[model samples]
Target: MSCVKLLNDFPFTFSREATYQVCEKVETRCSFLDKLGIHLAGIWICECSCGSSDLPLDHLRSDKGWSLPNRLCPCRGPLSILKKQLCSWSEYYEWRGISLDSPVALLLHWPLTMYQAIQLAFGKQLTNETTDELCIHYLGPERELYQTAVFGELHALLPGVRVHIDFVGPEVPHDRDGETISLSSYAHCMEANCSCKTPISTDDSSKITLRFHSGYYHDCYEELTKEFLPDLIIAPNAGIAAYKSWLPTIELIREIEVPTIFSDYCEEACHLAANCITSVTGTPLAIPVQLNPFRHPLAVEDSALLLPCYSNCFLFGI
Candidate 1:
């Protein structure tokens, strides 16, 4: 492939039907590996939670990259190409030494190592120090087991005054922590940030919401090294904000592990709002998305491959 072929394309397209058609025609030793996952086709790399466009594909999927792909991104996350092969952006093991086995811890970075940060989790030895490590350093951890802490805690005190979590866009600078949001901004797009995008009812879970999504939009090239592959990664708060139009709450939390679910349910809503795209740099909110480089580089192009779980480099919904 030529560098020119991998530069930039606004609306990146894939031959999903054609790819699938061809997939159906052939059979490999690992039929599952060769049977392209339906969601992997025709993705826009830019929608990735990270702040990078494709690394010329040469850097990411080159012959050399394929030889020692683990060196590509130390954080054990997913790859855009893998999504096409495996149903989830994760499942890196299928590709051999190309993905982060420790997806959740991979998202966190040093100064507060991902491993150390995760040590202070809900089920583990969660203490004021541990909670402080996560709350102060990462804002919120992105492990699926901690969904209650990340998504729950919504307690509406009165009518029209419900609790809710949201992504107010990237407005601040990088903090090496979790995504930061502007409550006022979320209030303005109230409907856009709902759990199911529906208003709170008496028993609505979101009535008591938690807003720990996208923060700053940047990449992990600076931190990740061949010598020291990150065991964890930060979130991709900014990039997700860049695609705010096509984003929502559930996708915010579960996009990586459950891309089809997010795409099937939230993609339409987010795509519809694309017309009013807002520049994240100009906003008053920002959060750092720690991800495992084991995942793909931060997605900045229009085509992106959401991970099966933390393996996807991103800040939850960002």
Candidate 2:
């Protein structure tokens, strides 16, 4: 059975078509170990509310990601029925046989969410062009630094286009500051026969390159812009109303007049951000707050509200 048909056996909040589209980009097994300078064994540890279990790498298959397993997790909370039907980052990646040493859904979320935001702001026709280059300034990155290699999926999603991302945030580690990394090939799966298992030929010039800037955007804005100007700016899980630190950044963004997009965990957060953006920029949002189709599939634990909350659940542009 097809992955989409199998996925429909369970009750998921997201559309099957959307999930299938995202899985295509995220299903690869490439660890980018050469890029991150890390080594690993054949066992991947699975963690959840139930606990951790060691899973052998060889046992994982592409079919496991879409179909709900007999036992999702050991947790038996009130919401376990729906939760058990949901899969983790590890399971989702299994569709394409991706088995990174420590895979997190956010690893896929960052790139996919950004891709969707770009489509929302600029339309899909622009990304489909083979000759056009897309430059993005990503703000407030925290845990994503550990798995930058996973972002190589962009090349597949935006085929033949070069994507340049400048990640600016205070959470950037001191040691990696001002570092630049380029991914010239698709993140390959471990399977020996996988189509993308080999390095991309040099003839394919498209690539995804990332740069790290260690500081608040307001402080680094003037300096960063000196080198590369971006076509778009993305801020994921931006708590605009909750933080005063965003004030200067918002001011600067308004002045630059760049097409900026932001995602938050909930509608209320996006609504508040919209108000904040208008307050700072003196204009309404270009893209009103709406649900992001590329949101993380699993429910977030210990959420403040009773409503379902996932990473980058809502998005808006200014």
Candidate 3:
């Protein structure tokens, strides 16, 4: 389907026809991977009072209750019936023989109020601590729907890449039991195995190091640049702002020369507002005009502005 037609027919809310169409497009895309002998795995996402949580939607229903509103989330927030909207693709893919797995990443393309977006973009310029609070707020309960939608589309486009979601906090241990630990411990806490050593597969025979870094640390950006050295960085814009001050993460990113994509769901006004950030920080900005056919209805196609360090790198919204 043409991206224009898909965008026109995009479903903002749940409906049988819309859900089926979206899932059908996903299945068609999965066929591409099948032709390459790549196994398809799906990630199902849903949110509850506990925060953004993931489990197979089918598993949730079978174990908890078929009726969603009555189901009790582990955090004790009654699961909303709307949570089911995020699962249509998973069900459709599984019916078509795709292997469904626990979500590898937590999507963060949450809709932002004009007031909130302005505060976030400008707030970090004023104070560092407020940026951290804003980052946490951006990831709060309200973000579930948009995050789920964009993530679903991203899964459809690159079904072969294994994605994992994690959260990092500010507290740095001077030493582990008084001895310093390597920075990889900060990026991935588990010592036995680390996904950082692995590379995300690309269809073109290129490998990209994708890292989702979230936290309110004074030196997190410096540590990540030194240790992670990711090819691409996908971070919540608000989180970036929160960690931006004192050390100026944006400047650090520019110095390290990695392509970064910031996600915030607002209309044209938001794009203009984000441009203000790019202008002040000296980051080159590009706005994607065409929606990727696989993008979700809630995916802000024209609104997401990409900030890159150089001309060779362009934001490929996934």
- Clash number for every model? 65, 1, 2
Q: Give per-residue CA lDDT, model 1, range 219-302, as digits (tens).
A: 222222222222223332222324533334323223222111011112222333222222322221122222322232212122
Model 3 stretches with alpha carbons more than 4 Å out? 1-8, 11-13, 16-214, 236-247, 286-318
Kindly indicate the candidate among 1 and 3 with the higher lDDT: 3
Q: Tens digit of lDDT per residue, candidate 2, span 261-318?
A: 9999877788888888899888899998877665765444455764555678888998
Residue 211's lDDT in candidate 3? 27
Query: Candidate 2: what lDDT?
Result: 0.60
RMSD of 1: 19.8
Off by over 4 Å in 1: 1-35, 40-129, 132-166, 170-209, 212-292, 297-318
lDDT by residue (1-318, candidate 3, tens digit) is: 222333334223322222343234443323322332222222122322222333322321111211111111011111121212132333323322323221111121221121222222343222222221111111112233212222222222222332222223332112211121111101111123433223223342111122233444234555444543343444332322233341354555556554444443322323453554565556545434122222223222122233111111112211
Ten-residue stretch with the least lDDT total in model 1: 59-68
Which is superior by TM-score, 1 or 3? 3
Q: Which of the two candidates, 2 or 3, achieves a greater lDDT against the reference?
A: 2
For TM-score, candidate 1 versus 2, the one ahead is 2
Q: What residue runs in model 2 are displaced by over 4 Å at the alpha carbon?
A: 1-106, 128-131, 192-197, 202-204
What would the C-alpha RMSD of candidate 3 be, to one decimal place?
16.6
Order of candidate numbers by TM-score, starting with the best: 2, 3, 1
User: What is the alpha-carbon lDDT of model 3 when measured against the actual structure?
Assistant: 0.28
